[model samples]
Target: MCHTGGCCILRRNRAGRRMTLSTQTTAPYPSLARACTVVLILFATAVLAYTDRQVLSLLVDPIRHDLHISDTQMSLLLGTAFAAIYGVAGVPLGFLADRTSRRNLIVAGVLIWSVGTLMCAVAPSFAMLFVGRVVVGLGEAVLSPAAISLISDTFEPKRRGLAVGTFFTGIAVGIGGSILIGGGVLDLVRDGLFAATPVAHWAQWRLVLLAVGLPSMLWALLLLVIKEPVRRHDQVFEENLPPAAGQNSLFPILRRMAPVFLVVAVASMVDNAVGAWAPSLLIRQFGMDPAKVGVELGLLLMLGYGGGMLAGGALADRFAIWRGRNGKIELCCLAVVATLPAAVMINSHSASGVMFAVPIYFALSAVVTASGLSAILDATPNRMRGRAMAISFFLNVAIGAGFGPTAVALAGDHVFGPGAGLGPAISFTVVVSYLLAALVLAAAIRTRRS
Candidate 1:
């Protein structure tokens, strides 16, 4: 009897040991690999999108000069023409992202945007160019929602902020590179690189656009390398987590996220308004040549906004991690608090002061704050991420990127007019926008925390 009891205890111990080993051995799964691969693919997509958009800003004068359009018209091209279609497409694409093959959809979107970019070079009239811009915007509509949705699925709740931030690096580099490349190309054109080329008569600027726009086709191939992650359910926690909070229906989730959505929209609008109008204002006010403006302002934005983007993401991740120990909401609130002061500084007195403040503003601008987007996704279920992101994109892009530029240009046209001092007026408009963004962001923080 004693021997039998000892043998039984040993058998139970061995069984427990085997269970632990089995769990440990199976822990490393394909999801992690899929996450890393998809993030890189999404990053490339972002790079392409940003670069294409930036090219327009750099080539704005050339396009304007050649087409004989007004400042307001240029703004329309940047804002409404692009934003209208882009915003409209986001909803349908987002719905598709939630329901269908996100990977294939993104690949197709990339192809569409690439074609749009290339078309911008060949467009013969203002109307045709407008069509190309619209196409570009529409193609871009697919990127953020789909990529963010995938990232939300790939990473655990705690890691989503960093993932989102990392994904946004394409934004930083894309815009920064656009400014840099635009300036460099302008210099090349000014120096007569295109003088001997085939399209020597084709404005050097048009040539530049054609060159920058075509390379993104290569990115279409990159999509093939990405593997879609396994979709998660409300239940079936892999790490012994409880069944995650389930997704609400579309209407319910929209209502819950509305307040935050409003704030993001206002903030984005203000940010875009400032970004679009600034370079033009600088050229008009400072007496800086276009090529020179491209390089200097480009570097300023690069270091200030782009670097800030990188820093903001890291800060948000660290803050979220520290606060995630308590709650993600509260920590995100703290980030809003920290960014508020920077918004005020963006309107500081001196030009140098403003330049210094820009990176701070750009940093605080939801690039890092957007890391919380994943938290929103986590709060819901797998199926809702695309729609939620679509709503966010619609509000953010439609209001921010879409209207912001138009508003600024219109204000510059009406209030400042063609002959009036443009620089200070434009600055005033942008400053107001940044302040409003701060207020909206603060409100968003409160809403998120609550």
Candidate 2:
């Protein structure tokens, strides 16, 4: 390979054309082993980010019981407060990711969110807890765009699905790990384990929060060793030009890719809604215990969410390789359709319902989700990707995760009146959500095809 001062490297582009791309970061064109390590670290970081977020749901009963708040109020802590601020912070952060050191951005997010997590542990009132969640959201806002953009730079488009999907497994793993690890903490707190220690006055829920939050501060230091990977570029589309400091034109690019972004937001609403509310439904309707359900939820989420995310990436790759651009979208549409039955069955009363239905719903969800994100990465040029992802983050979180759970809680509290309402609430949410997702996904397929 021809190179300049051992800094610049020669590489082949996708179009059977050779192109020489610049290496701007510390370790340019890093080895596959190094890249894999980067992915794994980011994966772990993703796990931490999600675990911090998901702990609230498992601790929901305890928090609400102690806080004396309604489900409606709790829903804000879970989704809106976090998602909204995360989305708001992400746009500018996305612009930064495009221009500066994504490693720095990522690490900063980790430290900030870790601090926010600790705030949740020490918060004395409902208002304070809500404020803590907002900070957590603000801190977490940096991860999606920065991390996804980093992954995009590390891997080629053909393999980006699997790479991004693998990164996303952090979502499942963190979520499951939260329930798994938090369950143990929940047990200890109940047994007065932490109370017996110096922090005798601490509540069970607060202890659980502290257990997860405190470790994250030290873990953020691990990321400092990993140098930022070289930013990869498309052979045909890129000029590899740096943006003028203030010249952030993300809107035009977003407008051009409106259809694809629409699918991301709509699809995420359904996917995140289920995640936000699934556990409460199980506990509320099935009369399951928190610790017991945590174990089950952990195992099921790992299998269902982790497997689904991985499968979706691999499937998107295979379909696109075999068919064409629209092949990826078709696979996405099919995955959306596949979830419909399981979505409905999740609310069923049969013993078999919880056994089979829950996993199926989770698995098919990522099939839809992974492809949508990968599609966004596919549509946008590498230079503009950070902003693109930031926009998607805003829409998906604000509309999807942010609102998904709140909508369910409201429906249950007002429409269904608490007890029997959760099942129907979930049923109505998923069925309508998946249907809307399918219609939008189908439209995206046509737009991509044309």
Candidate 3:
């Protein structure tokens, strides 16, 4: 319900002699053209952040084989190493976003993660690689929370789903781009496209890491032009330009928003597990090459994830308008339920079956992400948006990224004994986690209406 707003913020001139009052008007609330530009930039940022994160997905086999590690160890590389810090660091960073310059934080984050990614490409040992992953996690921890907070302020509540969804298309793009771009590069190098050259010194995986990670360093610069948005909640800003509240002050607020936040967490947990294990599924059961699979599925993933997110956001907004405030939550609930069939499709043994089903899963999953973020923004106040989103991201990464990938790996390695265990593990996690998410989302709607 954050509205377009006006406020009087006091500033001290360089002379430091007098307090100056600056009028904040609602007149320039990111017009459609400007909003499109903002969303495009955010979408691009999402792509970069995720591309760096998922590059490791393609490198899992090499990293594990080179390090002489177990699947569990590989899972840690994918999950715990990154998620552990992202979850905890998000709160403080989110606090910073609310209180300081989100644009600067994003700039710092892009630089940090990009450097961590480069460090990952050069790590001489597994320990060094783990440290790099931790650094990447810390840097990435600031993005979506702050981005979501900023987006919440840019668009009115009713239009929020669309704006947020547009920004998130980056997630889908980054996910697909990582595989397409990374996998394509790896395939070319392995196929000896660079055979007689000095570039032959580095391994394909290292090249893949460097290729995706390095571009983000340049992308960070684009953030400098972005203006921090005027803060609002529904139709009003708190009378005085008060100091931004701390995370501890947000606990009571967070407690009230728990049902929806928890829903987001569980939903993320399920989706992340599916995305992490998908490449392996294609490679293992269907005898597909990692390089080949990446090219083939990359387009599908973009369509599924990006297209789905756009549809979900726009639809959820309409639903909210037609049915009232809680309508958007209902759409999210349906999205969770919709994933059940997608889960079954993705876990299928046939390559064609899984391929056909995976995109559907991506599209359906978009609803949860798009609607969930919009819902959180609607429920919380403006000053608390960043921290609230940080908490949501903490839950999101802690459960989704932290546990999902690892759980799938463990299920395959320990529970199902590594042969055909992965498919089942992914399917099981999807059904259980997504079902729980659906129920929680529904309950949250009821809680709101209550």
Candidate 4:
């Protein structure tokens, strides 16, 4: 029989002897106030990281024009150049998070990526901008593994879903804020708001980059105040026996979690594709002003994506109570299924139709994202979470960030014949990616049950 005070289970051996095995439990978690403060700080860091990373989405056209690059070339900047290094570096950084002070790692990451963002602001050519993005990727790579690991260690099992959800809301805010702020700044620049400043001579896009990148340095200093939590040894075992073969290694966990990784990959693929191109889609297809699109779209994303994240967290916690660990994965599957209609609607003929659809798509994707992350934390042991999350980040950046935008561009340039076909191309990417995610998530749930 199992007891509540300590995680103990009774098992019968082949010799007909019953044994009780107890997994190690740590001291009580940090106080709720402390945990909340940690989450708030981490959430702020996440916002800064993503804002620096994604602000480029709003600068695509001006950058393309200034650099004299094609959409395919620009897509390389948006996806491959950054993703390649980010994904590759994440493995080592993730392992480091497992062994080192995650707080210090994040502080360092913030400084490096902030410099990278500044580098992008002054980049004179496409090559330099690509290099800058690579630096940003390198720096930002430290975030997820470290942050998620920190969250898992600081909170108990049941409350992790909400904590993780709150942290990810930063992502929603960053993504939305990138466009909202970028658009507002761009509009202000065009209206001569910066005419008196030395930066008035710079192009609007460069100004936007400068505006977004500078604050991250100050944000890094704030992270210094976040005291690192004590590492906890939290692992659940189904039976009492010798440690399973390869238990200490990450490969076993990776192999078991393959489906979950795929779900995140495909979901990220569509999410990045939409984020990278939606502005262009609005401007080209609907004849909307870039600044106008940025404000409206940005507002919609913040509300939709942000709301979805909170809801997902709450639902994840609720599902965990109702359906055990698998509930998180079940939530992911449901979100993917619901995303299909939203995906189709993003390609609506009228601008109003597309506008209405945008929030729905973003909101649903955020749901999947929040629940999926919680599932990963739930499935991985505390000691292994940093590496596990690193692997997931690698897949997310490498496959989703590395390939998603480029795939859409290639399709638009080649299959869809450029200008006229971008809307359809985005629709195709979202629909196909989510379809695959749905199937994989369903299989994961079934496997869990078996």
- Every model's TM-score: 0.80, 0.87, 0.86, 0.90
Supply the TM-score for candidate 2.
Answer: 0.87
- Per-residue lDDT of model 1, residues 1-450, tens digit only: 111111111111211221110111112335666777777778767866877776677667778888899777888877778888888999888988876777777888888887887788888888888898888888889888788777766776446667777776766655555676778777876778768778778877787776666667777787877666555432111122222323235665466555456655765676676567656655655555777767776776666666666665566456545655214344444445555566556444555655566556666564534544534553454466777788788877888778877877776668777666445454556556545645665666566546
lDDT of each: 0.65, 0.75, 0.76, 0.83
TM-score quality measure for candidate 1: 0.80
Query: How would you order the candidates by lDDT, starting with the best?
Result: 4, 3, 2, 1
User: What's each prediction's clash count?
Assistant: 3, 1, 4, 0
lDDT of 3 by residue, 192-279 (tens): 7657777668877887777677778999888887878776533212222222221125665566657778887887787778777788
Q: Model 4: per-residue lDDT, tens digit, 168-263?
A: 798777777778877887887788876889888998888888877888898988998888888875554334323441236566567776888878
Q: Best-fitting candidate, measured by lDDT? A: 4
Model 1: worst 10 consecutive residues (lDDT sum): 17-26
- Residue 55's C-alpha lDDT in candidate 3? 70
Off by over 4 Å in 1: 1-37, 153-160, 188-197, 234-245, 317-354, 366-368, 371-375, 416-420, 434-450
Q: Clashing pairs in model 2?
A: 269-400
Tens-digit per-residue lDDT, 1-450, candidate 2: 212222444555343334444333343456678768888999999888888887788878778889899888888898888987887788999989987899898888988898888999998888999999998998889887898778877876556557777887886577666676667667767787675577768887888888788888888899887777677544222233233211234455465456657766766776666666777777877788888777777677778878888888788778766665566778888987888888888777853476567778878887777777766666565667778788888898888878888888877777777777466777778888778877887776677557
Which rank order by TM-score, best down to worst? 4, 2, 3, 1
Q: Which candidate is the best by TM-score?
A: 4
